[model samples]
Target: MAYSFPEEVLEHVFSFLRSDRDRNAVSLVCWSWYEIERWCRRRVFIGNCYAVSPEIVIRRFPKVRAVEMKGKPHFADFNLVPEGWGGYVQPWIRAMAASYPSLEEIRLKRMVVTDESLDLIARSFKHFKVLVLSSCEGFTTDGLASIAANCSNDSVARLRFSRTSNNVSTTKLLNLREIDLRESEVEDLSGHWLSHFPHNCTSLVSLNMSCLGSEVNFPALERLVGRCPNLRTLQLNRAVPLEKLPNLLHRAPQLVEFGTGAYSAEIRPDIYSNVAEAFSVCKQLRGLSGFWDVVPAYLPAMYSACAGITSLDLIYAAIQSPDLVKIISLCPHLQCLWVLDYIEDAGLEALAASCKDLQELRVFPSDPFEAEDNVALTEQGLVSVSEGCPKLQSVLYFCRQMSNAALITIARNRPEMVRFRLCIIEPQAPDYLTLEPLDTGFGAIVENCKELRRLSMSGLLTDRVFEYIGKHAKKLEMLSIAFAGDSDMGLHHVLSGCDSLRKLEIRDCPFGDKALLANAAKLETMRSLWMSSCLVSYGACKLLAQKMPRLNVEVIDERGHPNSRPENCPVEKLYIYRTVAGRRVDMPDFIWTMDKNAGSPEVL
Candidate 1:
């Protein structure tokens, strides 16, 4: 017990240690001390400990239960080499497999892993409970069959084979509670996999295969509903359409949560008639997200479906206040709501009057976020929310309109309130050019949001704000501050009090301690630090490397985002976000690109 930290202390400590300086310290502790450390460390990606070999990693601390390896694919300016899949990982994994006997879950993302690697893994992973092979294009059904043959029936519960070329046997996929064969070419994918699920996944739940094409059909899930009486959550990729969703949920009886994302392709107006019809059949539906297109109309049927939901999201469907009021009033159990578009004040007021059970809400106001919204919020929005949801806990993504008076009401009324995720474009404040020193309205955040745990600040935060931030958010674990300048001393206050801080995101903000960063001479507690477009000197990068030697730093060059522009190219910018993960979540763009030249290897 001498060196052993308490479970709570270990949890708190592990949760906040974001930098390599902090992680290495956890790894350095002796075997007995490392056990407690391992519990907290499991939340992070396992393959990231690159500085330590698999053999050494096991020798150092041997109780790893779950391992997730981000399969390294060969990147040549984004043309992934088929042969490069899981090329170097076989040996490293063989080494890792030789050590851990208690491994439970394994997820290989965008796997460059081949048949040979999967063969070795099947033979080796004796205790693997879940196996996810995402984008493992090189694999065939033989490798998948091998995994099924090797894995004990009912032991391997969840299998996600996305974009894989496996010609799987129907009977081989039994005992699975969830099977996501999305974007796959699995020829025999049908109801054969259902016999084992619901029964195999007796305690199992949640199925997500929104983009499985026609390989997996809604009718097939009818067999799944018959077996797994407890199945509650389902996410379909426009396959079942919306109208069929309710019938599917009704068959399961235990179904509750359902959601589908936006549609971009050209379609007729009655495209989501299925969505409206589906809600009608679900007698016990709970969490729901409504979808409607360009034309605005009243959905009386949707209002009826909103009766018992605790969390609701509507796709800008409600044209008038009365329609939404009917929907909110029916949902007496409603707690959380997210709206991508704003409804009029009448709708807000109507919602406040009815949904007394509402607690947390996110509304992207009609007008763009500016200082005026702050005052307007207190009088119009905040008053309505306070009058209705007295037990409100969190309100995120609010603009600069969140004033001191509004902040005071929230603190006084919602005592359990802890987080206030905000983005204020103070530089764009109407009177920002003529503002006096003491006239800035930011001080209210520190004064009222007393127990703030997470703070995301953007748009020219002053030096004084940091002090208030560190003081108010005393239990802060994640702090993200975005700026648009060269040097701003706003970080000093955070450095003073946020000893428990875990993830720090400094965007477009600059500081002078470019050298002290290396003094992070291994700043161990900080794990996920993001510095984007900041006037961060190269010296600071070097310092970060020195301080946290095991850091997987991402230094984004904004200039690289523009290649097609001006006279010849036409478009001014070819943005990474637009073409990458930003435009669509399905395609997560390459976050960090390799700088490998020809004749060199990919993974370093």
Candidate 2:
């Protein structure tokens, strides 16, 4: 006989488990535990929207209230993916609307969301509160207006008022709480969406519209900010002028995170004092960003608010090293920083000396297409940060050159790195000091950093580097390669090893049919594989499609029909993923969907 816990006790235990991995493991314990876990689970995360159907998700987790779904490959942000490629959210929305009526949150990334889908969401979930669309596209302000006007209704307010008759004066009914649209591509159809919120609605806590390309109505925005007493995070687009920022700050002094919109204005004494005075009152501000078209004269106005900032983003601001050094000196508590390479090595050294609590750093190239090595940034900048910031764990550094010696030193200094992505601006760039492949440098990273989960390699590499990665990087989940590798052996080494690998992206490499067919079983365990401008052939793709019944192998040949070329001709691009939804129906004309059961290759 086995001792079993009571159902009540197990339910209590399951409520405390937060991660999806942990919760999934708990469900597989036994029959009773599976039933209890399914009933108690409230949140679900879908890494790839096409991997599983919405009906399957609803059937598995019947009581879920929140969902986070991602669509498109990571390289889609760089324009590698074509427009109208088919990551639509309408089907998922339609399915969930019929099942989960009490759903409160829907978070989507890199997906196409039309206005009709947004309209359906607003009319479907009565208790909807949060909508976060990051790096998504195919929606405009008209869709946003539907969300604002329809999310909270007057009937709910009246019911609340009737419930608390004596305390009606103090009670407020706000149904919606958050709308986060960071880094999303939204069309600015009109600026009147802010005016859609009801006068009594005071539920907004976080609002981010920083990615909008057009101006918004200023008066409506100011009023909305004034009424939302609980608003803590507010991000505005670059169209918001500098002069109007003072009034908004005065209205929302309780803000914990803010993005300064258009920090450029004429140098006037009154305006400068007002700006400084407004920032002096924001004692709770922690995260700051969005200094578009920043003027150096206006930088000092916000110095009083910089002492407590932990996350600072100046990627859009092209300030030189001297100004960057001055701003960094004031931020002693900075933990995460994103800036352009205009800061150079000098500014990073200053950052290393001052900010000891830093955990993450990203340096973007000021001008990626510039042929000359204009900026003074090099591997030395990263080495300095690693030497000074003992708690550093993640880095994304883009520079012109790197060396094996610097990487070895950095690896030794920070053995706790979880994500190390270094992109040399020039493709297939070699180590500047010795002019050799960067095999030893990246090999040192995988060997030393036992916890590395994501890696993007650059600077010349070869089969030797892949061998190092396959052997040592046991926990690596995502690997991005471009313009490197000697032959199919590089891909073979990776597929043979890396048990936990989920996503692999390759471009301009020499990998082809031999390595792919040799390890065909490995594709079943991974989430996705994207190869473009490589040596993979159409025949190998067709065979992979035929052999693996669960995988959907798609060939993107925009030049002409797949049958027009020889079977041995190399395909222009290949995208393979495991999917339970059969084949996507909305594929464009250029896409060639291989069928598993067809005797001959048929384009669907």
Candidate 3:
């Protein structure tokens, strides 16, 4: 406690504290507002890039310049963290190449990133501008042609790539605009890479390679969209079918985000009146994702771009329920809807009587191995979209059965639910009209959704619904349990009450080894802990890795040595986190690391 002012008036009151949670509450209000919010911190997210230690975020943000991390653990996109289970971004670009050498942008997700850490972040940040990567993998296209011939920072605009490797040939990109290569794995996205743009390249606005498999160069992508009339956004792939999507929607009818390509063809009524008269001359289309194989007689050719569509991704549309109630009864200002549980439950009750400004919904599972008696929507179509979408604030409903009066009438009609993922696909299935346990419909969702931050639970829970989610989820930060709970005091009453629990994902249930050592000192400030198939043992994960010697504690044996088995079996899978770059030189060979006196589980 010092400065009642000065230090340039506390860096001008922490430069209007641009929320990283109000500059982490004024750097916990002390130590001179934590050295003036660490000399005016500049963008740092790091949600588990080894949960802290790029030399402790370059010694706590000394003029940090945009970092946004995240690597492997989002259950490694459901393959469940296998292949060399570690997320490396070359030790945070060799610890921010000597502390953020004025690093610019570097957003990465589900990381692994190689090509020598993108050629040491293109020779370590000389005003390196933006490098976004998502669901990343070992880098390719020779590390994106060494970040397009060494990050020539004309403040590099955008270069989005999904699931890596499309091979960016050499480099040109003058003042590069945007090149989103979605779902990549390209060996050839049809011939001569659209003649490497630049026949007077009008700074291309946006060009998404919609999961290319082949077939491109349609007159060099319509002469680079007719010499880029500031091309808005065009995502094409699925080998661009349906008769080349009405000549690329009549040359990008001034597209404002349209990603449709292979929506099947052959039934010509002049291909649904020439693709609904080329999407009624686009009228600044507001966002519609690629409709691969979608053809319910061309769903009335997108009802003339559905009243200024506001985000509709049909997750690879499988269309049913009256062609998703005639394409969600013509959008009606839809606010984010991702479908394909083949839209049953009368297509989400005609999308809650036509999209009452619905704020996000996802329903995947088209036939993810179908049958929970052929699951279609339940809980009476999720209480008729929570009694007609009172602005539903985020959902990911994958249904089979549900009830407790339809989850207490969707927690009294969507009490501003911020991300509630209800996936009752017959696991621990209960509450179907009072079979009980779903403890008060998830204790009325953390006691009336007090701004819930991500919660995913299945049915038939107990230990009084993890003791009402550890006495009313104090703004719970991510919890996903499956097959509900019962003992180990429901994971020790959510590790002695959720004080903003970072992340915990359990599988199967009945947690073991005294509920995996009842959160020994709450797993070092929680950022990760995943249990699989439950009933933990191997001497309670070697006594919770000898009482959290700064937690890394992995144990995901597929089978083979937990020291040649029988330390009371039961440890099938567990993975704890919190690493300052210790033990993770890409540990694979059946992922087992935790060796206090190496009597067991070590082998890389």
The TM-scores of all predictions, comma-separated, are 0.63, 0.96, 0.35
Instruction: Show where candidate 3 strays beyond 4 Å.
Output: 1-48, 51-69, 72-107, 110-132, 135-298, 302-312, 315-321, 325-342, 347-430, 438-456, 463-479, 482-489, 492-514, 518-527, 530-546, 550-604
lDDT of 2 by residue, 171-272 (tens): 222277899998898888978898888776777899999998778889988988998899999999899989999999999999999998899998998889
Error of 1 at 185 (Å): 17
Per residue, candidate 1 scores C-alpha lDDT tens digits across 207-253 of 65543434334454665555556667665544444445445655665
Model 2 off-target regions past 4 Å? 1-3, 151-174, 599-604
| Candidate 2, residue 557: lDDT | 79
Query: If both were scored by lDDT, which would come out higher, candidate 1 or candidate 3?
Result: 3
lDDT of 2 at 329: 92
| lDDT to native, each model | 0.49, 0.89, 0.76
Collision count of model 2 = 0
lDDT of 3 by residue, 1-604 (tens): 4665678877787778776878888788787788778877888887877656677677877778888888777866767666777777897798787777777677787787787987787666766556667667675555555554543324443454545677543332333355555553434524446655446555567777676566776887887787677788888877788767777778778888888878878788987888889899889988888788877787788788888888888787677778778878888889888887777788888889988998888887777666655545666776888789888888988877787777877988888888888887778888888798888988897888888888998878888889898898888888999777777899888888888887898888887888568667887888888888888878777777777777778888878667777777886678888777666656767777786554256664
Relative to the true structure, candidate 1 has a C-alpha RMSD (angstroms) of: 10.0
Query: Global CA lDDT of candidate 1, please?
Result: 0.49
- Candidate that beats the other on lDDT, 2 or 3, i.e. the better one: 2
